[model samples]
Target: MTYGYIGSMRTRSGRRDDVVAILLSAAGSLRELGCRSYVVGLAADDPDTIVVTEVWESKEHHDASLRSPGAKEAIAAAMPMLTGEFTSRETTVVGGLGV
Candidate 1:
């Protein structure tokens, strides 16, 4: 099944730029890993909060990318900028529903 992931993160004090840079690098790495779509956007009302949304061709592809060295390294680099625990959720696309 096609897979999607949503991740939410909050940046530490004075780390918004660092976090954004990390996310940009991570997005590029995810694209190289065959992600169908990847987006990292900051919350308009809260500059410290970031939301990362990604879609993969399949669950297997997503899982494999998560286990890749590049992904791990990117995550590690982003960790220090985090203010609190990140939250993530994975889901399978059931229907487009013509949004």
Candidate 2:
């Protein structure tokens, strides 16, 4: 079964865009690591929040991607900009359009 992950992070004051950029910088490389889809979104009413949605070939693929250098670098770069507040959920992707 495909693995799906939905998560959100709260960035420090004015750092949401920066964190988003860092996350996107690794988007191109994620596919090579088995990612099927990766989407980033901002809340209309929350300037400090960033939401990320991802689908992977499997749970193992998702796990491996986190250990990737690009992912690690992105995380390191964005950590300081975040408020340490987050929301996340892992799901089994049954079927979906574009996914």
Q: Which candidate has the top score in TM-score?
A: 2
Evaluated against the true structure, the overall lDDT of model 1 is 0.80
Best candidate, lDDT: 2
The residue-by-residue lDDT of candidate 2 on 25-93, one tens digit each, is: 889988888899999999888999999999999999999888888778889989999999999999999
Q: Which stretches of candidate 1 lie over 4 Å from their true place?
A: 94-99
What C-alpha lDDT do the candidate models reach, one value each?
0.80, 0.92
Query: Model 2 compared with the native: what TM-score?
Result: 0.97
What are the per-residue Cα lDDT tens digits for candidate 1 across 8-61?
899887888887887687676666676878888888987788988888888888
Clashing pairs for model 1 are none
Report the Cα lDDT for residue 20, model 1.
82
Superposed model 2: Cα runs more than 4 Å off:
none
